[model samples]
Target chain A: MKYHLILRVVTRLLVGPILLYGLYVQFHGDFGPGGGFQAGVIFAVAFILYGIVFGLRDLRNRFPDRVIHQLFALGVLIYAGTGFVSVFLGANFLDYNVLAEKGYEGQHLGIIAVELGVGIAVFAVMLAIYYAFAARPPRIDDKDW
Target chain B: MELAITLFLFCAIVATAIAITTIRSLFAVVMLSGVISLLSALLFVLMDAVDVAFTEAAVGAGISTVLMLGTIALTSRTQKDIKRNNLIPLAVIILTGLVLIDGTLDMPSFGAPDSPAQTHVGAAYIARTADEIHIPNIVTAVLASYRGYDTLGEVTVVFTAGLGVVLLLGGMGARSRKRRQEEEG
Candidate 1:
């Protein structure tokens, strides 16, 4: 059998579901218990699992650091941009009531946008931290364990 | 039954902490810390703080555990037995714990209807969430609409922290490394 046969198989089987679950937590935060922070961590966990199994090189190949850099700023921009948009619409900063015709609709839109920003920002940070730590050469080897 | 479960969780958490302190293996200590976080998450659930519970489970137990493991990989797995004066630190910890426990005596009992937290802006948030925001989850409404500025600030901090880590540990790219090597040649 291949090395870490069970782990690799399980990780492959679970990555898709984990990503889906993360999406569910992200989009469903308005109605459910979780919000952006939790969803972002869950999303990053999927890649983390893949990286642990397949190796960091493969993970980096799939998700280039350049993309991570762009996303790191993009999330915050989306959040602040929502506020600026509301301000331009003649409402106060982050005042989502002016986002749509109805106050509630605008609030809903704003929450989703802001939460999306949170989710993206958190995901990038978590993955970036992971990469920083994991990229280092380990003092201990597999046989040492 | 709820109290029983809470008591069990608390006891288990204390036991995990003791185990963590006694254990020389850094790997086991990291795992024990994750256990403490997971137990704390359960306690949050019992207190009806589902959102807090979710965060504790995901970030505290899940992500932090992975990060700690990465740290262990970079460093030694065994903790050094540094025989030093820990009495002062232990005394300070006990004093801090006692002071915190004393402080809690003045606070309202768990889930009391008349507690300051539930009676003040929390009450208003609950009452107006359906009207002003119309979101089913009041927590989301409070976090995103009522407390949008706070969350925006938090996101900015996360972004800044990530940028710092990238600057500190992450080399820009392989291309730069290759260019440097070519220059050296």
Candidate 2:
């Protein structure tokens, strides 16, 4: 990893754009052809690329396993929380129509919140899985390939 | 031009699948799987399923490949040649493929206006999106609003999978810490 100067430099340049693109997909999902699922994967890819080029230690230090684990649950909580809030407001579970004064406005608000939750959960899960796999010691050496 | 592009992409996908099956090196297999995902993404784009294409490109071509490579790093690069009789499995696959094809024959043609999917709930979702949800993208409206429960369930599924993986592999982290402690001690 240390030897790949080009890779390091290229990854450094690409990570920012990749993350921004993920955000774009997450927010713009309602208008365009993307949502939490694609955005989350894209977000995880940026960090995973950084891990591949820099090192697992650096990545882990930047984003700890604890935070990843918390975010993992936080997303589902956000989704369920939105539904519960709706129920308290005299609407059916996950009924976004009552979220705001205007039905469409409420729908927009609900979708965005739920999508954010989905994005967070998916992103954390992908990264956590990658970390789990990469943290282990390889059974074979690099030269064996 | 569109048909030609679609045909080419399909051919590439088939070639990649064949290569994946025939290749012994796990690394090449992983890369080819990525290639197949990318090609399928292109097909999705061609079919105007951009959201699906994006997901396929991101998850299939990107994350899955990386995960598989990580798995290879932990395991071995070369695949083990298992000397086992494969005739039964091959026959099963062929029979399944034939049955699936036979099932498809009864289905309506691709994009048929009178198709059940086009006429049924799909039409209702499309018609209601503008006035009901006021979202431009019908797919998102359906996924996030109309089918909110389903999306919630999907997120829960992902959460569960992540939890399982962490629980299964949680010991690796502790084991490594112990190894480091021993090395230092």
Candidate 3:
């Protein structure tokens, strides 16, 4: 990793754009061909790329495993929370009609909320897997490959 | 042009798969598998399933390949020679392939408007998306608003899987790693 100056520079340059694109996929999912799942994986890729180049120690310092664990649970909470909120609003479970004054608006709000939950959950899980892999010392070194 | 592209993509995918099987280097195999995923993603896009294509590209080509490479790093770089008979496995694969091919014959052709999928609740969902969800993408409306419960379950599954992995492989912090290195020294 220390020897690959060009790789390090390129990764640094690419990480920002990759993260921005992940956000675009996350929020633009309703109108476009992406959603929470794709966005979350893309986000994880961006961070993983940075982590691979910069080192796991650096990445873990910036984003701890504990926080990702919380975010992972939070996403499920958000999705289920949306459903329960609907139930409390005198509607059926997972019903979006009662979320807002207008039915369409409520649906829109509900979709956004749920998608956000999906995104957070997917991203955290993906990152956590990466952590599990990187936590162990690699048997093979970069030069060997 | 579409048909030509599709043919090319399919050929590329088949070629990559063959290469992957023949390759002795585990790294090359991983890279080839990634190539297959990318080619299939292109095919998905050609079939007008951009969402599916996106997921395939990200998860199949991106994440899985990286994770596989990580596995290779954890284990060994080269595939060890095991003198085992491949006849039974090959026969089983062929039989399964034939059954799957036969099954596909009964299904509606791709993009058939009169197909059950299009004729069934698909129409209802489409009609309702514009009226109730006001969203341009019927997929999002169906996934998040219409079939929200299913998606909740999917997210919960993702969460559970993450929890399980972490529980099994916990203590991935810098402090633990540093302590391990110190112990090694």
Candidate 4:
């Protein structure tokens, strides 16, 4: 089925702004109503809209399977690595105070790093789910008997 | 102002729940379920449980709905008629609902500042968080630092779930390959 040009254009315009807004939420989460999880979902929604419009095959082509898998692992590593750094710094896991040893600015930096990790993990997992379902072959029984 | 928004959110939650349960089509049910989750997240916000709401809105409304729809696409959408009655499950649900209502009768009122949850650890966390952690978003500070172990376990659970999916799908493929080889031989 052919998608309407107007609908596609509108989706593109809205998605771009929504994704940017998600990033803003991620960065400004320290003083706002949103955090990593909300930002991640907002980001995922943008790509999901793209998949809905352009079809799953095109989405897969745009973001290959290997890249998504690596991103999934990388996000976890980033989160875990932050915690590991704390351990090396003679502090407990995820100890933000051990980050800069300066002041509140260091804490803000740590929170941003962790939030970004969470956002990336969520975004990759969401896309992975979409790719899995969208790429599945139609059941033989679904065909005309 | 928040109270007005809370009332509207409650109504939205109830409406979404009704819409989800009453829908006949499986796909429609899945989509409506997502809406129900989103509404619940809004309700959580009104309750000042922003962190819980964030997780709910993301995992419940987003990923869970997509997974359910994907499974439905693999299976038949039509609900099969059960020859036997579903009296037992229905009775259990009704009884559970009754128990919940009974329990709530003795519980604290909504947004009671002096409630137990908001008194001890909650108050301590709120008070000392800024001095100890220096993080503006108290939720992240609590989850990642104060309760770091719990967060680690949560991440492990997610990783295990992903591994389980890979194993199950791999097994299915291996079985199919073995069968094909036997047929060829």
Candidate 5:
């Protein structure tokens, strides 16, 4: 489908900022409203926007399915790894206190790590689902809608 | 003023939800659902649930809309008129709603100081988060540090869901090959 010139241009301009904002939300989540889930969705939005404007082919080339599949599992591993590490440090499972000498610092580190895991997993899943749906041929024409 | 805003947002949400159900065009339905999500996000903000609001806006309005659009692209644009009876489903829904309403009637009023929710660990979490977690946001402290196990479980759930979708969608190669053969055959 041929997209409008304005959409194409605007999407190009917007994708970078959207991605930056997603990262900002992910990192600043501790002090602010957003956390991993929200940031991940926002991050997925940038790619989704790119796919919509420039075509899914362009998006798939830049972000191949293989990498997405790996990231999907890797994210969960990161979260679980943090817990296992805490356990190895003579603490209970997912006990962030053992992460650092100072309890609060450990909590801070654990939160960042866990939130990253959540963000990455959510981001990949959203894109993966989008790819799955868009990969199929449309039964109806765009004009019909 | 808060009450007025809450009422207005609720009205918008109800109208959008009704419109979504009544609309035959899948595209319009998707748009209306997004509107409902955005309105709900606004309501969440009014109730001082900013994190929930952020999530609703991003997931509900943003990603879900895009996913629904992709679904419409793959499937039919307009819903089919089915002759199947929905009476049983309607009755089931009404019964569930009535049960839920009855349950709520027994609960404490909103923000009651002595309520079970407010009394049990809530005060301790709020009081200790500053000293223990040193985080200004108590929600973050609880979610990340205190309740890390729960968050890990949530991530695992998301991971499991992603795995299911990948398998259901036929990974990559098999799906495309099947599609090509279908197009050619």
Candidate 6:
């Protein structure tokens, strides 16, 4: 319907900007009011909006179920990998100081990296869930030969 | 100013709780619960617990609402009427409220700089964190470094919940395909 098209266009315009702002919040959270979790929700909201307007089927086709599953696993892996890397470097687990040959800068870098991982994982899992719930299975018609 | 904010928060909490308990529609109750969580987060911020507020706002208000709605979609929207009186639940809630008020009688005054929470290891952490971790936000330093183990546990809990959802609601495609084959045979 005409209303649906309007919603789609509006959502398309909104999603991109919201997603960008989410990334900005994720990175700048060290000095801001937001952080990894807030960024994750904002990122997820973009896709939720897309699913609402364009239909969950189209959104799923764009992201796909398998890719989302992988992203979920990959996010956790990135977080755990950062901790493991710290252990390997002779510091305790999640010891960001061991991340680089230098000192405090390494810790900062490590935190940012881990935050990014959490954001990505949370965003993907949330979107996958929303899509899974909203999507309806196709129906077959008896007249379809 | 702070006292007024605290009063506002207390009023909001009571209002939300009443709304949640009395609302007949499940969706309205869920949304009101979210409002309660958000107000509690603001109260946390007023208490100078920014990190806790952040987590609460994100998890309690945002994700919990979404998850609850998903569960609602999978279940009944309205509760079945019961023949019995709901007096027992009402009595239990009243008893709980009385016990909590009694407990608060022995608690530290709000915003007291020398409260036990502020005097304990928390003070040391705040005082030494700048030199020790060099991070401006002591909350971040505490979360990502000093008590990183707890953060790890929190992450694991989230991951487990994600797994639980997948187990409960996922893999539908495979099951549906199998059902189709059985019907054909």
lDDT of 2 by residue, A1-145 (tens): 8898999999999999999999999999999899988899999999999998999999998898889989989999999999999999999999989999999999999999999999999999998999898888788776776
Docking class of 1: high
Ranked by TM-score, the better of candidates 3 and 6 is 3
**Residue-wise C-alpha lDDT for candidate 5, range B89-174, written one tens digit per residue:** 88998999999999999899865789998887988999999988887877878887788888888888887887787777665844
The list of candidate 3 runs beyond 4 A from truth reads: B171-185
Question: Each predicted complex: what DockQ?
Answer: 0.81, 0.79, 0.81, 0.30, 0.77, 0.30
**Global lDDT of each model?**
0.90, 0.90, 0.89, 0.73, 0.86, 0.74
Interface RMSD against the true structure, candidate 5 = 1.2
Model 5, global lDDT:
0.86
Which stretches of candidate 1 lie above 4 Å from their native place? B171-185
Per-residue lDDT of candidate 5, residues A49-144 (tens digit): 999888888888889999998888888888889899999999998888989899999999998998898899999988888887777767877677
Q: Clashing residue pairs in candidate 6, if any?
A: none
- Give the better candidate number (3 or 5) by TM-score: 3
Structure candidate 1, residue pairs in collision: none
Tens-place lDDT digits, model 6, residues B7-102: 999898998898776667777888889989999999989977776787688778876787677666666565666577789988998999999999
For model 5, give the TM-score of chain B.
Answer: 0.87
> Where does the lowest 10-residue lDDT sum fall in candidate 6 chain B?
B168-177
Q: How many residue pairs clash in each candidate?
A: 0, 0, 0, 0, 0, 0
* Model 4 DockQ vs. reference: 0.30
Model 4: how far is A116 from its true place, Å?
1.8
Instruction: State the lDDT at A131 in candidate 4.
Output: 64
TM-score of each model's B chain? 0.89, 0.90, 0.87, 0.81, 0.87, 0.85
Q: Per-residue alpha-carbon lDDT of model 6 for A51-96, expressed as tens digits?
A: 7676665776687777877887787788888889889989888888
Taken in order, the candidates have interface RMSDs of 1.1, 1.3, 1.2, 3.4, 1.2, 3.8
RMSD of each: 2.1, 2.0, 2.0, 4.1, 2.2, 4.5
TM-score of 3: 0.93
